[model samples]
Structure formats: C-alpha cells, structure tokens
Target: MNHKEINSFYTYLQSQQTSQRFLYQCYKKIDGIDAEAKSYENCTVFMYYLDHGIKFYNAGKKLDILMQPILFFYGMVHLLKACLLTKRPNYPESTSVLAHGVSARKRKKKDYTFLEDEVKVQHNGLFPYVSQHLFFIHKMPFEKIMMKNLLGLIPDLSHLFHFNNQESMINVSKIGSHTIDFTSRVLDNYHLTERAFLERIKPYLPPIVEVKSNHTMFQIVLTKPILEPSGPFFVDDNQNIFFPTIRENFLVVSEVMVHYLLLYNLSMLSRYEAEWWGDLLITKPDVDYPFIAEFLRISAKKMPLLIGKELLKMK
Candidate 1:
C-alpha cells in the first residue's frame, strides 16, 4: 500500500472507537470457541476475509457481510490444518525452504545432485506434512515481519484492563540476565543502528519512554503516566539477539541492528519479567502463551470496532 492508503487506514482506525466496542462484543460471543479457532486460525481467516471483501467491494460492488466472515472461515480452515500438521517452530528458519531444485552450471553435476538430495532429506525431516502446510502460510500475502509488527501492537488493545493492577503488573527485573544475552544475539545479526529502527516506528510511539541497552540486552519502559486514556499502553523489552524490539509494547531499544521490528506490551511485566520476556521472545524456543493469549483477547476486542468505524467514515 502507498503512504496515502496507509495513512487513510490509520486515520480510519483512529476515528472509529465504536468499532473496538463491536469487536469486543464479537470476542465475547466467540470466547468459547477452541483456542485454535479463537486465536491463530480464526484470526488468519478474519484477515483473509477482510482482504477479500475489501478487494471485491472495491471492484464496484455492494458489500457482503456474510461473504466477509465466510472467506475468513475458509482461510482459517487452511491455517488450522497447517498448524495441526506441522508443529510450528518459534522461528520460520527452523523449517525448510527448498521446494524444488534445479541443476546449476557452475557446480559439478554430481555435487549439485548430492546437495539437492541432502536438502530434500533435511526438509522432510524438519517439516514433514505440517511443514509443507506452514510453508504456504509463510507465502501468504502479509509478510511475516508485517504480521509480527501487527501482533506487537496487540498488547495495547489489552492495556485497558490489565495495565496497573498489582496482580497484572509484569515484572522485568527477574529476566534481566536472559534479556542481556538475547540483546547480544540481535546485535550480531542485524548490525544496523537502533536509532534508525526507532525513527521508523517513532510516529507510533508515545513520548517519554525509558530504554536500556548494553552489548547484550535491550529494554524499554513506558511509564504509566505517558499512556493516553484510550491506549496503546504498556512497556516492551526485546532480549533476542535477532529481534531486539519487544513484540508487546511496540518499542525498539537496540542501537545497532535492523532485521525485524519487535513490538509488545509490557504491562504484565515486573521489571525482571519484562527483561526475560523480551529475551525469550527474541531468542528462546517456546511461544509465550500468556502473552499471545492476552494479546489475542484484546486485539479481537478492539480492532474490528476500530475498523468498522473507519469503514463508515470512508464515504
């Protein structure tokens, strides 16, 4: 999308606060669905349906609400099947990339064949049936990096109810050591200045953020007072050496790397947990279930309402 289109969409989102309310009601109605249906699978379908309906509607046609959700449902089925077949790795690289191999003139024929065979074996071993399905998902129109950025914003949606309660406050101090290690890894991979990354995302950020970074770690604190009444609140810390921005608070803290933008909310963090969660999402082998669940809950509640209002205002 062009800058104007992006700006228009964002403007629509900002203007339609009631859309968020509608989304929350939808989530409340759909809450009892299986986690797979509620979270990743359903979300994939929702996005697909939105994309399809928007495309169709733009082609000089009336809107079809039923078509929108049905398209989403079909898309969700494909993603659900893939998720079930292949145990998705925390990172995409863990899966195979080669679907087919062609002979290369520069390499000896025998050597090329050998390499291809090896790759095929490795692909089969790592991905199996599920991996192939996942490959398709990766190929979907929305780039993985874009999805990551979008997902990073999810925490803000949930901040309404979770930000400052003692029970909900996330501790970051506990994860400091891990965060440091992860930050180092990110530096090794990207090698871009952190300031550039921050500049790219600056328009989306609130003022007065607290950032911490060393050769080995990066952390950001969004002081509670800075949050707007209608949010996009929470702190974020990225401990992964490859992705230094927290995927929860939409903040970037590293100064010298630029492979991917990490954004997340840190409202649930204690100082230590913030540090550790940052590190884990960036480097570790597991998905942060609580983090993912909370984000899904809030985004589902808020985003649709926001989008709906934007749609009404478009005319």
Candidate 2:
C-alpha cells in the first residue's frame, strides 16, 4: 500500500465503529499483503494496524487466544518505544514537603525514638490496596526482560530468538499480569511447537534451586507453578537433566493455564467497565482525578482480544 492508502486505512479504522470480527477481517487482509510493496511512509501506518490488532486480541475475553498476541504486541510496542525513546532525554527533579513537629532543645534525641515508631507506623499503613496498573507497567517490565533473556539462552532456540525483532512471535504469557510474553515470530521462525521447543532446550534450562534467592522466590511463587508438570526440569550447559519429577510439573502447567484464563476474563471485564467509565470521564474531566487511571482502565479492558489473536498464531 502507498502512503495515501495507508493514511486512508488508518482514518477508516479510527472513524468506523464495528464489532471485533470486522476489525479482524481488515487485519487479515492487510497482513496478507507484502510489506515490501508499501512505501517508507506507509511503514508507520502498517505498524499502527499491527499495534491495533494486538490491542484488540489482548483485551478479548478468551485467555487461550489472548496469550500470544499480547506478547507479540508488547514486543512490538517495546521495540517501537525503544526506537523512539532511546535517545530522548529525561529530566530529574524533586518535590519539597513541609515538616511537622515540636520545640527544639527540650525535644531530646530519646524523645525522637518515637520517630522510628512513627516511621514504622507509616510503613504499616498502605501496604495492601496496591495499584495493579503500576505493578503491571513498572514492575512487570524488569521481569519480562529477564524472561526474554532466559528464553534467549535456550541454546538451539537462541538463533531463532531475536529480542529486537519487531515482527517476531512468541508473545506474552497470560498466566498473570507478570507472565512471560511469547510472540508468533518465535514460533514461526523456529517452526516448532511450544512443547517441542521446551523439550529441545530442557537440557540447557538452569536448575530451579540454582537461581538466586530473590529471583528464586518470584519464580517459585509466581512463575514456576505455571510451568509445572513440564518439569522440575533443569538443564546443564552440557544438556543434562537434573530433576526427573513429572506429575508435579504437569500440575504446574495446568495451574498456569488456569491463571491465564483468569487474567483473560479480568481483562475483558475491565475493558467493558472502562468503556462506560470513559464515557463518564469524557463528560466530566472537571473532577480532580488522574487521567491515567481512566486511561489504563480503558486500555486494559480493550487489549485482551487483540493480544490473544497474535498469541494464538504461536500455537
């Protein structure tokens, strides 16, 4: 497609209100064409469609479908954002806060022993109701980067794994907000089933107990279960297997699939709720509220289906 056609396509997508099926058809048609035929100017346009398709699949109500697409979309967005933001400067600044207190000389250091107590009190406060969005956007990236690195180390799969390939598959895992993303590019490039890929690299996977304390906790608590039934399997550089446990590993995989389904349902519900919330917010931005709260709520709701489709291709 030419630049004009690309622009027209984007404009049409932006303007048309339709069911997800219609949008999917459009994506299938565009994706079927050769990228080489498109002009440089149309590249961004094509990317936008790809991005949109991902968003749709991710927000869908089906976890099974949402898994791969979300990963792929995330990878694409990560690559795009990295390209655009890498050289951009970020400024650092701090805010000042007012202090509260009592008199000077009479207030001995012992009197301030309560300061430690007060600090403890503050720490105890607000430990629960943490923001999920912040956790997903900020904390999850580091974990994902690590997972990507682990997948990268999978010997034979390493050649097929391109961390920087924008179009690569083996997109995100949907086990949880923190699950590893896989993209279709990985599957397509490797030409292997997920099970086959895992089995091939089983010999190289690090021992479960060998991982560091901090990393081990998260992996054990959050990630290991999902990958269970597959193995307590560990790989040496020489491709030797350590743990031969089988039944437990399979159970873990089953649990992982359940978690993925939960996340998928949550994403769908959140998106549906966000649409109504967005309408309400649009009519009243006068209220003192964070736009990001609304933005994330809406975005989360809409992403599952789009991301799901991209992931389904991996299978």
Q: What tens-digit string does per-residue lDDT give for candidate 1 at 1-315? A: 123553354344332242243233344443343433333433333344444434432331233221222232222222223233222222134334322111112222422221121111122322233323322222212212233343433324223224332121222222222221124443334454666544543453345355677776666454332221122223232211122234333332211000111111222121224444444445643334344434433332332333333333322
Give the runs in model 1 whose Cα sits over 4 Å from its true position. Answer: 1-70, 73-184, 187-189, 223-315
Q: lDDT winner among the candidates?
A: 1
Name the Cα RMSD for model 2.
Answer: 22.1
Global lDDT of each model?
0.31, 0.28
Model 2 lDDT tens row, 255-298: 11222222322233234445433443465433212222332333
Please give the distance, in angstroms, between residue 160's alpha carbon in candidate 2 and its true position after superposition: 29
- Give the TM-scores of the predictions, in the order they appear: 0.23, 0.17
TM-score of 1: 0.23
